[model samples]
Target chain A: MTSTSLNNTVPAPQSTPSYADIQSIVANDFEVMDKQVFGSLNSKVQLVMSVSQHVINAGGKRMRPLITLLCARMFDDNPSEKAMHLAAITEMLHTATLVHDDVIDESGQRRGKPTANATWDNATAVLVGDYLIARAFNLLVGFQSLPLLQVFSDGTCDIAEGEVLQLQHQHNPAATEEDYLRIIDGKTSRLFMMATQGAAILQDKTEYMTALGDFGQHFGNAFQIIDDVLDYSGDSEVMGKNLGDDLAEGKPTLPTIKALELLKDSDTEGYEQLRIAVQTGKTPNAEQLIELVRSSGSLAYCKQRALEETKLAQDALSTLPDNRYRTGLYQLTELASARLV
Target chain B: MTSTSLNNTVPAPQSTPSYADIQSIVANDFEVMDKQVFGSLNSKVQLVMSVSQHVINAGGKRMRPLITLLCARMFDDNPSEKAMHLAAITEMLHTATLVHDDVIDESGQRRGKPTANATWDNATAVLVGDYLIARAFNLLVGFQSLPLLQVFSDGTCDIAEGEVLQLQHQHNPAATEEDYLRIIDGKTSRLFMMATQGAAILQDKTEYMTALGDFGQHFGNAFQIIDDVLDYSGDSEVMGKNLGDDLAEGKPTLPTIKALELLKDSDTEGYEQLRIAVQTGKTPNAEQLIELVRSSGSLAYCKQRALEETKLAQDALSTLPDNRYRTGLYQLTELASARLV
Candidate 1:
């Protein structure tokens, strides 16, 4: 439509394109795919269709589905209709979970606007999310790859499990890094892995399938760490949600957990204060605690770990043959760990 | 051990197998297989194992998983270890969804006991449910059948979808039998279908797998109808929960919908009162309305349809080779629909 779009579509982004550049390519696919998926949601039942449309039209970044498309394109030039269908499905699954998460969190806002739960009742939010998921399965059945279905299904289970695991770990200072990893693996990385691996399954690329799975796993962990860190340090307006909502809810995100572990021995007063805050669900002074973590270098420590995971993600990509999209995926790892707001 | 225990290498009910006989038989395998699958949960993390155990021990009827186990034993002489593992996974998945359901439903009690949300917190309830689902996948991986995993995974998605769909239909008097069927299929039948078909997948019987799926679909529909009827007619103590909780929650159960449809012309005053009660979540003397439905033959009408489904369930068994467990499964379907209390 625009000159820049024409230029990019003609030659594609260069090898190892920047995050913005990659997003531009994905934007095109996202728009087309969304229309296709949601369009098919039309039904004879007006309420079912209307409610489904309201939920679907809410808009998402479609990052997970983008990864799926990028990975499929990276491994092979000739992608099938199944790859596109699976890509759509990946987004649908992700979106379905988001609506349910809103209900579970009881949050009033998401993506800078009222969440489905907040706009409608929790009942509609629940049903719309369900319709999206069923529609996803109905679409995935088109792929006809039993293994792909298995992988995606397993990922969904992992996502649910991860959310549940995190729920149990809340307000408990004893929550370990291992527990944190398990939670992220289930909640975050599992879907990332499914998205990429599902692409591989569709492409029938065995060798790259495992590698893509690893890439998604590491990248998802890195992405979640950045999200946790941003929760503590970033601007609420830019991030599109309240800062420290997780902490207020008594969730032990990476920064808080690591900071608590660091201060366990020396700063008894600080540690006890933080523990009391978690129990009472009132951070005595939110900004002061944020500043303390910043000064203590725990945020920096988490950032470094996130960067290391980025390296692991890049290393996982080495199994695939050289291609522009592959290199773009490698750069995506770095972009994920980078601070945006 | 008692003489009855010696006869089965397992504990038998003191009152003998009666109302929930087939369910009890299935529950035995469920407990054993869950312990086996969750053994890994203990090796890695002691805390999650304990928390998960506490949640699992909270007690449920094991309806969905029982259907799976019964279906498995129906087709084959001795169900495979994979079948047992899948059965556990199915129950865990059901439990995971239930815990989340309480949070969404804001339910104070489940099965006549305080809900996880009431006992701990919404966050904890959410996390524990997630943990159960995660443990389910961990268990599922042992079977390593992608098709099997896919079926269960799709089931999970459907479960979530069904919950959402039912939420959308809440308090909408116009919600049709078709709408209710779609909701229950996602909520109730999807898992039931998965349970039976998952077992069939393990047995490598494609033809019977389809038949078993249909059997679960019909039986599940019938089971949910009975459950809805119990909400109106059954004693709270015997049913293990309050009789009118569904009405209080504004859930448009089948009997209520049917009752509303039948009473449209003559009982305008009563209907308006019913509508107000649902809106305010207050029970405004349900005796008259309940009696009206009882006399008008809607309950009996629903019961008749349930009986028809049971016949369909029994007819499905003809597709598979005859076995004692198969006959037991048929009996279980009749029991599910025929029970008054």
Candidate 2:
């Protein structure tokens, strides 16, 4: 049940730059750019900035920002200074959404640590989230692109709508695959789309920009589905996450939903019991539940879908000229789907 | 100890139609305009619109949007369809702040009714607030003014920082007036400045736009100070709010902060008791405290400052051309200051 083969493969996914690879190219830039964007949090809003940076520094992949920078680097020889700013901004936006998400979920923990809301109270967390988001726009507006502003704003709206849709389905056992897809697209992928598309916009890659947006969107879907799958399949340390967090929150994630659909009437009662346990926020020793999902091929089903999305993401790269960076982006999609396998 | 004379003479101070009066001319226009702005909430994002309308209809004064529309009407004969859209956007941004404020305060009620957070849940309320803010930008980006987006974005950042300032001071008895003033200016007046200035930008009134922003900021400070006074000195019903709601939340409103500063050593016990009451979030018998504040003339002190700000607001208007709407704006400054007389 604990797939050693899958665990081994996660470290060498085809599409993703290994953490070391990303670091070699952009780590110092990430630090400097983040300081510039967040340094705007000065004497007046220092409290907000201090608390927010503390939260951000805790641990996050910086994947969104990296994707943005890589997308720009792919198109332009020496991507303008605006690329760094946009990269920092997309990360800020993503961070803001996470803080707000913690508040929405009433979550005390995130990424295996105490969330800002848990440590500083909901008011501080909420305000800090707002501050980060406002700062993101502040950085973006410095570039003076109405089209850029429009794209990011539309993305934020989609994110908010996705959050609300997820809220409506809390503890709802009947949450559909379609609903899950839309929610993840809005909540996670839209930001990914904005990040990639914003970079393309900066590079003046008008035609490729739209394609990059699609790529990010599809990659994001695959990324999130794998995340959901890992909620069942991942190691606490390896994933930097606690398993069953989604189920504990009654998230009705794809594997759980699919497993529920696949159950026989007699088995359905047992599944309902597990669902009840999830809804009530009791994990109920769900090893057998994981086995049920794996045995029923529900996990495989999700993997298949994730692979399809990864294909779509890779196909989006065809719009761009051949380059190492483009190949790197193509590899990210392969890496995302490979996580499930 | 109530100033019966000031209360009696309240309506004697202003003879002109205030900004509210000018704004009323286009109140229905705002309704139509809001519909058009929010109508963009597509089928996928309709949840954002429905919940947003619920919160909007929950009864706010529509002050910011009215300022926006009146400013546009004053500066130009044709304020562009874009201006109307931006006006609606301003109102939405203001409403988003209020909803988030209610969530942060954990106030079950707002505007004499249950808040969106209380009526639904914090999650719904938070997402809805984000949606509105995003929607405001979505509307503004259509006008294709990078400068306008910059203004709105900066105001929002200031607002977020201001809220954080207030959060840091909550329940801290030593919070100074300077701290209080800075917070209020950022949280409240900045948006008001942006609202008027954004309108002026549309009319291409560069000099007058800066003046209008100054006018709006000063007037907004006066308006909020008066509102704080009313929170203490006026009828809960007539003011259409819960009396001492600020006290219950331990908010260091003008009256309470002043009252606390004036306390003597023997009054230390009483002050501590009041502080405990504020911190514990219990409904104190505010009658004695109200009398104490009255005797100290803190209410009068705050009102004098309000009027001073109103004068500053009026003087700023001199920089603008003589227009009927501008006259109405000047009258509105007096109306804001006179609210708690």
Candidate 3:
């Protein structure tokens, strides 16, 4: 178990705990919520179960569900099991989006594991993705809480719209930072907000709804911006996807969008090269383009923007009750900004 | 407007009405419901709107909503606008499924119009289909009825499961009638049941739930069976796809499942040819195989099954009121059987 185990012998925090520290604080919830994720996939169809299990098992950090758990504890120390179940449902919804995103991205792997589309066919992946979505809603209805269903359903619509909006902007270099924000807001951040807001709704702590919403939205923005930045500059092995992937797909994330803007003013020839690459999605000179974005100083501007958003997210945490769970959320934003380094 | 308009003169049917006649019986509800289908696609993304509108416009006869409207009117002569809204959501969910289905089938056209996947790419189609689904649940939440949400969510899971189950059985020549029934129940009839049962719930007619379910399941079974049978024998010009499309995809529908069963006992050479064709999805001698199924009399057996299902659906209508609406439901089943002839 090492020093990281979520056991009875807990140490007092000297400072903001690490992301792993936040995870261990909620480790028991995380452990049970992880099982709930797989347990929720109770499809009678064997293929549905297997494919859903595959994608959920190829789990991301379960960050969205973690937000739910932290928010639940923030409101009241010993929250009901609904929050864990809702956290699982949040992750299930996130998994559904990832499965479809992989199909849309035509991705072979995620987090160094073969994606559902790669393991099975697109047809199976698409349908299983659908099952995950339906099952998520099915489980949400079990709470008998219309308010929870409301936020999740509304957020889900935004998620899909964000994805479609991103596709609409694909291969179009005219996309702006505003457009990039809108894209991430839907494709990435909506679920994050849902994660926190869902906990508030579940815990009957609706008074914290606004603060949780702000925290979720800002943190989500910061998290997604960092992720997009990582796509350009981070270690591909650690990221589980190659750098310049967004560029290869012609996705004009903030970094790319800013780089295009910065290059438009400073270097005319460089601007055309990047613009043509973005417009065409033909990245034959991939290394040069990656170098161009890295050298163009847009990453610096994006890093600044990410920090600003993180500060905003952390500020939102101040209005909520002060506890380790809130500290966990604050450290989460810090950890997100750390990825920028 | 001719005698067909829903303006006023909904004539009394002396016998089972025509499909169009039954359609005219609920023409007012159908008109509003049809608009609601397009109206419900409130996506902010232009691409989402365009693709969603494109597919919903290329709609079938709105039969599922028709069933809902009929069920609503049978319970109360004048149903609420909620029923109309619910009916529209039904079609929206149905459209979402069709969009995904086109992507899975790699279909070029549906109802002689370019499908979303054909007009846009699979990524756009898949995501837009996702938007349609999310939007459906989002709208369903407006009803504020837990029971309504329960049925729709559960049915959606079943619908996706059916699709996955069909995919699981694909290219398996050993698939049987039992397997085919299970697949169609999940894929085809589950939504049909939701359509009927959703109306009963909206109209506060829970007492009629079982009968409505039976009507939906049997009619869905009959509708799908006839459609699959048409793949073998119907006119390609009207159906808008080539004959043996399912066989080409290695989809073992009832005709194929039963034909494989019948051929094994009577004609060994014919059986091997059909079996290999299904197993490998290499339908080189397509006409020869189609004729082999026809000669095997699987269509005759399938038609009989369709009639029996149609009968069960009509018998379910008898448990509800005996108004023009119930009459409309009865004639819908009859019209479905007529396609067999």
Candidate 4:
């Protein structure tokens, strides 16, 4: 765990680490944070417990909290228990957003598991999501750090705004790349920035904040772009979701926006088809639309963009202290970019 | 504004003041707080602005903020702009809860106006409601008072728990009067408590915190009780909702719970009818069910309970320094109870 051992154990930049590789570095902290995520649900209401535990348990790769844990250790080797608690709060907030998102999407399953909305009902999901959000803030107040509260509160507003903005742009083929970036920055990257920057604030490593925020934001953007690309190109069985689920929902992700842009001049028929699909959310030609987007050279363009963002994210991390934890963070961005490949 | 003037202007307990009469006392402050409730929604996202403004406009009474403003002035007549801001934040939180509640209840019209969920969609309403909650917390963090944040955050958790608890007891004929009280205490009274107690915290009037909280809790209980009573007894035109709406939704409010308790032994046929209504929420005998609840004497019992709660709330004001603001608060409680009469 010492700096020397960390440096010797760290891999060179050429090889990307798996998520497990990064997590192994902070295995103990992850265990405690994982427990705290459920332990924090002290609601006397049984339904709250059942729905909250279901959603939290159904959560995807605790990446946000993992980032928080890594960043906390990147500053001080032996960070306080507050770091683990804050990490748990981040996961709780993430879970709350997911529960609400499932309700909004009216999705029956996520990550191959039934959603809270599906398992219980919309009312149950919404209220339990609310309980998680409230409890997260309730615990954040326990930290008694106004600066921490400010970062989180502000970020939460941005997150909500981002989700709403995406809804606004839904079915609009004219949505620009800038709009896509703005949406992802809010809905995805903002929490990442909070996770890393929050660690700096909690550890009194304020000097590292700007760098950490940059790392989080760029990585978040890259992560989301990869996710969008995967929606068009990844294995449907592996994703546990059909291809173009976003398009079916009329979501204007970067791939769709970029495809529309690239197709407008050269292929009017293709442009009209995809544009109308985005507009009406009716995919009579689902396979053709997927093929149209893939054939439009937009996926390649998106992969290039994802790589650039990943690079920027890694570059931002170069400013932080060179340590095992920092290496773990660097590997995380690489792992995310690897998804693009 | 002074104690002497307050005593002279105060009406006898026998006559209750209307909400408007109480509001007129803080007319200027109320105006500014009303503007702030809209002004605080400074979301750059156009959709967010639209939905937030729509819901806030559809909001009823602005009672919570009024409580906040009154409590603020009661402690310090020259309360800071932060007080107005806090009052607005309280209203925002209240609106957020209502928006989510509408979604949970699948309500179409509230107060004779189309709800955000009805106008936009459940997705939009859920996200915008979330935005309001986040923005409220963002503003609360601006106060830089950990104690204030503590009060609001804790109260928020209680509110969510209460809502979930209500959901837990839904469609259960056996839901008790105690369960009903607990549900209202969390769902309705907690915010009222926060409204008054938050004002005390911001104004550094810690000594009045207990009294303000007690006033808020009891008043909240009374307000909800009257609301439930009205669901069965009040004019649909005045209430802007149907009689037996609670029973239709399978919500076991105080009136229904009490009615079932009262009819279980004395009127077996009435008891089974009402019990089936609550359990099934299939009110084919809607009129008969309403009649059964009415004849069971539960509305009168609920009304008496409401009166007792109102008296307790007014009595809590006795410890605070008597002034016009205090009188305004006392009259507010009386007005709530007058709904029963």
Highest lDDT scorer: 4
Error of 1 at A261 (Å): 5.7
Q: Which ten residues in a row have the lowest lDDT in candidate 3 chain A?
A: A1-10
- lDDT against true structure, model 2: 0.76
| Model with the higher TM-score, candidate 2 or 3 | 3
- What class would a CAPRI assessor give candidate 1's docking? acceptable
Off by over 4 Å in 3: A1-16, B1-16
- In order, what DockQ does each candidate have? 0.24, 0.68, 0.85, 0.91
Candidate 3 local accuracy as lDDT? 0.89
Candidate 4 per-residue C-alpha lDDT over B92-154 given as tens digits, one digit per residue, 9 for 90 to 100: 999999999999999999999999999999999999989999999999999999999999999
Candidate 4 chain A least-lDDT 10 residues: A1-10
Distance from true location, Cα of B106 in model 4, Å: 1.2
Instruction: Kindly indicate the candidate among 1 and 4 with the higher TM-score.
Output: 4
Question: What TM-score does each prediction get for chain A alone?
Answer: 0.90, 0.90, 0.95, 0.96
Model no. 4, DockQ: 0.91
Q: What would the TM-score be for candidate 1 when compared with the true structure?
A: 0.81
**In each prediction, how many residue pairs overlap at the backbone (N, C-alpha, C within less than 3 A)?**
7, 2, 0, 0
lDDT of 2 by residue, A62-138 (tens): 78887887788788857777887888788888888889988877888777788898888888888888888887877
| Candidate 2 C-alpha error for residue B247, in Å | 2.0
Candidate 3 per-residue C-alpha lDDT over A232-341 given as tens digits, one digit per residue, 9 for 90 to 100: 89999999999899999988889889999999989999999999988988899998999999999999999999999987787777777767787688778877888877
